[model samples]
Target: MEMIIHLIFVFCYPANNRQKLLPKSPLGGCHSMKILAQVLSAALLLLLSTELLAGPLSEYRSPVAVVLAKDGHWLATANQTSGSVSLVDVASGQVTDELACGTHPSFLQKCLDGQHLVVTDTFGGKVRILEINDGKLLPKATIEVGFEPTGLAVSPDGQTAYVGLVATGEIAQLDLAAGKLVRKLEVGAWPRYLALSPDGSRLAVGCSGESRIAIVDVPTWEVAYTEKLSGGINIGHMQCSADGKYVYFPWMIYRSNPISRDNIRRGWVLGSRIGRVRLDDSEYREAITLDVPGTAVADPLGITMSGDEKRLIVAASGTHELLVYRRADLPWEGIGGPGDLIDPKLMRDPDLFGRIELGGRPMGIAMADDNRTVYVANYLKDNIQVVDIESREIVREIPLGPSISANQIRQGEAVFYDARHSLDQWYSCHSCHYNGGVNSKAMDTWNDGSALTMKTVLPLDNLSKTGPWTWHGWQVDLNDAMHKSFTTTMQGRRASEEEKEAILAYLNTDRFPPNPFRAKDGSLSAAAQRGKRVFESSDANCASCHSGDYFTDGKIHDVGLGADEDQYEGFNTPALVGIYRKVRFLHDARARNLEEVLTDFHSPEEVSGTRALTEEEISDLVSYLKSL
Candidate 1:
């Protein structure tokens, strides 16, 4: 009876929010109302019981990565914003433990010995080691590494650990015994995540920055092979088949370049496809690509396999759910030719599981050895959700304490009111410059392949901190920047005076939250103190351009980092408040890190800017800027 009731409830509750209503009787109105009340009471009782049996999804915050551990006894998850990890008991459907880590732990992996757990902190640039004793987590160690350590992978022997440095485009190899860096290897641009083969002979590095995967030989630490991908293919996370014959990589492809006014107005389309590559073959061939339906953007982040490798678990971040695909049944070779790639018929319905809501941005997924349960990390909500894989139901939710939500974040308040302007429809200042700030990376143009500067299209985040906005630094004031966005970039009707006032109020409000690491006494760290001395010293003289509280002079100077056509002789110096968040540096987004930005030679015409600093000084300056 219990099993039947569970089945009936599961069938009635559609994965999407829509609830199916029973047909109304043609009886008298009072009788109909009585019947409706009875049905409502029954439904309410069922929901309450479900909550008692399986914890509500709302309890878990932003869960990004999920891992099944302890022979299905425990499930672990990573929460990005809350900076915590959670563990759930499978049998009782209850949260067993929730422990805090550093900042923004993106990935999780259980140690080979099953005694310790490892998590990578992308923003904090560190890896946390937690010991598991009787299903409880105890902090063991925190090892600092290169900039933006996004992805983490443990060797098959569990002797070595490889961390992908997203900002610096390098991989830091760690000696597990000493808990220190053994060496750093230069890989492709923007290396985010890694997948080790079943045999553990090779490691496939997913390079989102360069749109390729470089295979690194384990023993020799040499590049074994490189697989190039199509343009706009943002290769995120990947997984390997149990047999180790095939590799599946999920890519988030941007349909259009977001440069021109039309493209910006229309917004960008993001889609996901699963590309299968043979492990043994040197040549690249498409095995299969699945385009998920009903999702606006296919932002797939994590991929895993069932215990038997019969099903593939994909975490579609855009949709906030787990998509289980039947591997043997999926069409691999018969999609189409190169020109007509991807077949709609080949795509099938994925068994959707986990939270199906707006706030649950699922990032990583993993399965228990028995394949009976799955774990998912909610990135934004800061929690981990445990799901029964076989029953296709979320059974438990573990929460991370004291997390912020998008709605809770007050929008930047607008300051001006232009009666003549028309307001945009269904779009806010946070649309392009997400969270009131934009990525420094160059995006593709809409009409053609021409690249456009990111600064010109989106400039709301730090306008007060840096003046002379835009890539060319044409707009001198914030009002001008607002005008250009509405008239040219937004391509919407001008906003009314009242609407403009509201918009400006929202835009002007604090975009960045208070710095979590700001010193209470307003003093600098020892490293930052040395760095400040180097910055103002004549040897480095960075203060000549970057001066004042915001760390920017708000004036254009010849940095000598632009092309001949782009050579404006001078460009506006941007603020350094949150410099560590930006992966790319310089106006063109050419340099991968701050070291490169300060040291790279742009042109022979002006060498003074870059020539002023040594490599060590540049490192010090970067450290200080990150502290700011």
Candidate 2:
């Protein structure tokens, strides 16, 4: 059962609405010792009663993207888990249509004509075009693109479209009329968000895995400049300003290299921030912290500017609130250089004009033409929350469909995304393991009270198959790993035995996605075939360590990368499955790319038993490894 608090906020609302305060919860705020004592007592009683402990698990829809129709009469949202696009009537606040898009729809964009919609079928690896007439969506065509397409952007003339091939690290330009790919341009790792400038001269692409943004010259169809966003990871959502002067994006900012898990409580680890960068010179202009004096905002995802350009709204996913900031209240001129610390003191005293409560885990947000009404796709609620920006109140919660019963796996998934398990609702497991993958940040967990070695984030897929979890092989059992993670990483209490079991169950459900390198017949390429022979040959000696169906022998090897400061004996042999999606490699993330990992000292002869391989052999080997 998820802990849900539905309260009417009046902190920045009208004076007349201030009297409608809801009863405070026992475990509501951080400083209430009396409330914490009462909550603990209540929790003890609940645990004692079997009926109270075994409550029903709630189902979450996991909506990803939302957009307003060109005509502004209806709202469309892409429901990722449901594999459908929901349309709601703006005036009535009722779901008028639910159209089957495809498997795991990630993003939606209404065409300029207002009669057509383009949706990216992320897992299905296809772009679906649907025609909308009077609120009903009719399937038009489905164009197969590269693997795991997520972000979508239509050309200014509406004759072409560009999609971010997340797994392939490229952008596919599609001809709308022919319904085929015109060309594919290599960008960087995991291009998750694409935003075309207002003038359609530049396309701003946020490469989530690389922590960088590439500005593509639209006319040349080539990258003009790349901007490295310092101290930020998972740069997913981005919005270009009205004048195309800058791009505003919400990203989780790492204050410093996390030396210990204790840094979380001290507020020196992860913080939510809104970043602004100039497009002309490609400079990382500024990063403004979203935290106030006492409250720390976390997981700022969806960001948008109001129609009047006076207000900046950001959806704080971990906090479950919409942080509204007045443009005039922001200290734009006083912002420091790129190296300056993102101190909360540089911002306005109150920081936000209002913190309006929203539905569970809001991800994507879209404002109406008037900008007064905001449509938020609530990931955990399976609904769209219509919010009145002026009054800072939820106008309506438009349910997408009837809720269904969730099983143990779903329960575990809810727990994985629930921030309540973390102290002060700082973050959840999903924050670091975004989309069951890495956030592309090196963190020092201080697991053994040592901070010298920073560990790179790993993927969560095929968890049951890979044992001896963590880079250092700290915990062989998944249960112990979960317990230690909660107590140390999250700075929270240990979960119940049942909760741990449920989390493991959910983790076991994850399976590796299809390898895009394979042909239609599921056969490897010529290069991969050659590479497979080399991988299993005596010269490589890879099979001795990386074997079995899961690609690991369940062992740890020194291979001579461990430094003196490392507390552990050796590094765990990580699986090669889905290796193409990795942005960084090795335990300490010393090798930034696969090529570097293979060419580093003590890597070829020590890890693979030979260093005299030819360049072609190395290329083929990399190709085969990526195919896994």
Candidate 3:
């Protein structure tokens, strides 16, 4: 602050007055003084901008969710990394105000009243309701939902709100007027997105982890139907049709296969897609392979339709582009089997689909009333990109300030999320290790000698510490592991040495929030304490391989879980730090959940060659593991 004040004075002072502060040497001419003033002016402006962008919004702004004002005078963005919400004036393209939010602020929803703005603080597990008045936002109320509160949907009358709780697998219904939770409706795993129909009669919930969509009848507040998706993963933004006839969403598909270049090109290993389900009858369904033959789409995170209902827009975060599809030209059909899936080559039809390369990660989309103007939240760039739909070009970028210097960590983050470096812009490392964590699917990275042996995507939390890397315990070097991830897993060009270094620096910064499963003071519960005894006891023998402070011995163990075709004789011991967040368990993902692992496939006798855990013991052990 002192330095800033000093610089400001030097820059603001008249040249003659500043001469007193400069040296009396002959070099201190009027011309030199004028040049110094110009340099000081630029430096001061930059310093002020960077400093003001603080409060956790400096290097990585991460604007994942954005919303538009009803009158089209202003817009707002929910930044995840910065944990703040920014309101920008439409005409000026400058942030009017910024409010500090929570641990991770995600999806945003606006009410018909245009005064109430709802934001889900994802990791903080709270729904923040703010009132828009006098061109600024003021905290109106807060509703404590549950852990990992993500996507949000509000009623047409602005009286009610539905919040998706990712961890607990439930949708919290909040009475906005009362500022409290009314009740919670149980949904499938990872209910991270919610879409309210235009008529406000139905709520569509995207249960990404379970590969299904749950429809809730708003009048009765009950799940009317659950639509199962074909190989769906990372189901992101969903939008109901103007007539509420169908709900469309963008997601990725993964088929368990060898990580081969041919398979990737053929869209057999992993692919991007857009799915539609008929809400009018609750019987029909449609999905499209968004990936074309030569160029593939990745990480489609945001979706919105034009007011005229003529155009559909999707923001592909990984690919860093906007995918535009004419509503009339979409190859919509029911997905009944592998053959029923839409042909990827069909996307090649003229005027069927279009692309606008948005440089940074495009995470959220908001269409204006004019139908042709759209605002997109560019996560990596810390700005909102305005694009003209008719022109299919970026109109302008309204910066949200804090121009961070190019550091190695920031440089690596760009590489980590950049899909352009991948094969034809299909996917990045983050497509699997999502948000520096893990994706839901089991993928074959081909690190092991076996081709078809699949392994669950490991969490990058505390990655640098837990090594002897892959599931097969080969590739001890972290840099080599990263290199292989690109060349082998993504089938992309070999990553440069500098790229690997920056990525490692960024990966080391990945962290998990406080475990909601644990007590407030972070101590184990009574059940967990009892389970701790079982875990450490020789009878269960869990700590034999899963030992040490990081909860892994960093050694290979037989574990009795390897498949017959696996060339590797043993598997590396995985750490148990954040197992609560994992839905898929075991190296092959045979156990859908941790409970299934403890009771069915990975019983004490099955993994550790010890006595089987009784029912009470299993419950206690689950409690203990969740606390970690």
**For this target, which candidate reaches the highest TM-score against the unseen true structure?**
3
Q: Please rank every candidate by TM-score, starting with the best.
A: 3, 2, 1
lDDT of 1 at 549: 81
lDDT of 3 by residue, 1-628 (tens): 3233344444444555566544354665676576666767776677668654333334466788888888898898998876777888899887766665666788887863777688997777788888777766667787888678989888878888898988778999898888899999888888999899988899999998888999998889788998987667889988998889899999888887787777777778778888888775677567777776677788898999998888899999988899888887776667453332336545556456788988888989999999888899998888899999778899999888667765787788889888877777778888888778777778877878777777888888899999988887886989888877888777789889899898888788744677877765788889999999988998778888889977899898886777788887888889999888888998988998777897778777787677888888888988899888
lDDT at 387, model 2? 90
Q: Mark the 10 consecutive residues where model 1 has the least summed lDDT.
A: 411-420
- Residue 38 in model 3: shift from native, Å? 34
lDDT of 1 by residue, 1-628 (tens): 2222323333333434112222345675456446645655676577577553232123334566777765777777776544567766767756555566755677888774776778896656678787777756677777878477877888777657888887667888877657778888888776878877878777778877666778887778877787766543456677877676667877744443554434432323333466766665555745444342222234566788777877777776655566666667666552342222334544434343222332355678777776766667766546666667656678776665445443312211211211112122213333334335543335432211124433222345555556776655656766655655665544445545555545555555443433423343557777778788887776666677678887777787666555554524567777777665565666656677767666665321144533556656667777787677
Worst 10 residues of 2 by lDDT: 1-10
- Return whichever of 1 and 3 wins on lDDT: 3
lDDT value for candidate 1? 0.59
Compute each candidate's TM-score over C-alphas.
Answer: 0.66, 0.86, 0.88
Error of 3 at 284 (Å): 4.7
Q: How many clashes show up per model? A: 36, 0, 0
